[model samples]
Target chain A: MSDSLNFSYTVDGENFASAGQASVQVKKELRQLGIAPETIRRVSIAMYEGEINMVIHAGGGVAQVNVDDSGIEIVLKDEGPGIANIEQAMQEGFSTAPDNVRSLGFGAGMGLPNMKRYTDEMHIDSTVGVGTTITMKVNY
Target chain B: MTINDIKNYLDAEVLCGEEFLEKEVFSACGSDMMSDVLAYVKDQAVLLTGLMNTQVIRTAEMMDMICVVFIRNKKPNEEIIELARESGIAVLTSSKRMYEACGILYSSGLCGKAE
Candidate 1:
């Protein structure tokens, strides 16, 4: 258990029901790896928020996690309509998500902030109409 | 309150995790918004949400929540139930609306204790 491990999943952009599957898997795997509950929780929460963002905004995307003794890193890449304003999106309660996404209890504009809150580091790169990539880390 | 007390208080049906009924929960929060629950919830062992989806189970899991009480008699699908079962989160349904259910539990001394 001295080496790093990597896990990847393709987020089903169209299906909101299946959104958190990858984060759940990561949580289980981290637990089995004997990661502390608090660390596992932080990583899982951040990743879950990112996963939901992928489904709601980007039309599905790639989620990759790398775990090691030092920390865990999560990378989410999406090709949906890219974020036009990252600053605006980071503010709590500022949402551009449509009515349907709001009904399901997301798009409250807490996604990015929640991700940032739970992680040690977070970075976002986006090109409107191209895609968005979010990288977050939770250190062990 | 122990999950059993919540069950008794709400007259809710147990959807799963009957084995966990005796477990105690310190605080509870009711919200249909999963993200709001995630952002605002802390050390709340029970989640009362009407939103029926796998994300509900996942949100509970993320918060390390022990129980989910679906208000307004909203029943989760089989997948959500299975997910909750797997996550070791107890599931229950209450006919009472969100306000009434939370009110009952709050009056019974369950506050979403600040962390």
Candidate 2:
């Protein structure tokens, strides 16, 4: 909140139409901040995937982004049926989303993997029935 | 190829961004799954998908894509067109199926990741 630029948004669960609103806002802000195209692209894609995941799985959550001199950090928190197996879930093509979500052009089991791939650092913390918190960072 | 060329190639209809026909795109891909597109796409300027939804435009926005071609002559609703318009992306609809559409674009020199 001080020198570091911070932005936050509340993601609505199962709201497919508005899922990427936060990511879009972040992209615009990053562009206005004059962040490099490559960095902005990575951050936006990763953040968008996380936002979609929040809607599909956790029913909605919170997204927070912090931009500093070193890099950018994205934190996503959702209170849903948490990932039962982090190891299996990390594997590409493994998804817990229902078929209805797949019909909407997502739930390909690539969201988490794609998020990890686009970020320099990623961590996932989850519980059986509580929720999940994912932290991702991309260094400048 | 430019968005104009795609219109001529597939005999497609421009649903939005008709004024931006001269836009140039280097690569393209066709998929209904937005996740797959987001996961594997890199520098692909055109998205050929049958999926008609706001997320289609949102995905293109995230990827910085210039055009979205709806395969099989699938028409997007007014809201979808508005999203594409606001996102500054050209939207087109082609009668060609996904396989044929991709093939036509590929043979016309719009290479995918294989290139």
Candidate 3:
């Protein structure tokens, strides 16, 4: 933990065009660290999905990534309308995103599922009317 | 096959990463929904889609895709092309529709499975 690298970014929900910036940067950083391509891909894809979800559903949020000897951990925190049903939201085709968001090539209801699929470990903490925090990890 | 092979097969015009036309790609997938691309894709080297947006390029980048062919001749803007260029991913635009373009490539021996 002491020698771990920490990176954080404020995801801008207002700009859909820039939603995946954090994930891109993280990917570059991971690559520079000489992480395995598969591990980096898993971490970046999971984080990218989380970033898009924050922009589309939570009106933006904060993303934090910590890389240590054991693995990489990503935390996405947002203060928006929290998910009412986490299980239902996790379904492959379940989505609450608007039609316009779909027009941008997402909103097929695969965000959370994809995140869960890529990461070695994933956890979602949410309260209706409050906010949501998701934690995901990829082993090194 | 190489990116050049895809370019010739689909009659696509290279928009960027011309230097990478020699890059080899073992598999391909065609889709408009990026989430599906993200979910089902496993080491697919080339992506064929009609969707036009920076997210398309971003999705390819996340999946570590090597080439993106925009079917229906959907020309992405300068920003989208630049993003692909930055990621060292080849960009191609073709007049063929998604189904036909995919068929041509599939018949050319490109499967959805990674080599």
Candidate 1, residues B17-79, lDDT tens digits: the string is: 999999989888788888888875566489998887788888999888999999998888898
DockQ of each: 0.81, 0.91, 0.91
What digit string (tens of lDDT, one per residue) describes model 1 on residues A28-95?
99899889998888998999999998988887899999987789999999998998989998999898
Q: Encode model 3's per-residue lDDT on B15-65: one tens digit a residue.
A: 999999888898888999999898865674899999999999999999999
Off by over 4 Å in 1: none
Q: Write the per-residue lDDT of candidate 3 for residues A1-140, one digit (tens) a residue.
A: 45989999999999999999999999999999999999999999999999999999889999999999999999999998999999999998999999999988999999999999998899999998889999999996
Off by over 4 Å in 3: none
Q: Interface RMSD of every candidate?
A: 0.9, 0.5, 0.5
Residue B71 lDDT in candidate 1:
90
Once model 3 is optimally superposed onto the true structure by TM-score, how far is the C-alpha of residue A90 displaced, in angstroms?
Answer: 0.9
TM per model?
0.95, 0.97, 0.98
Q: lDDT at B88 for candidate 1? A: 95
What fraction of the true interface does each of the listed models get right, in terms of native contacts kept? 0.78, 0.88, 0.85
Q: Can you write out model 2's per-residue Cα lDDT over A1-140, one digit (the tens) per residue?
A: 23899999999886799999999999999999999988999999999999999998899999999999889999999998899999899899998889998999999899999999899999999997999999999988
Q: Candidates 1 and 3: which is better by lDDT?
A: 3
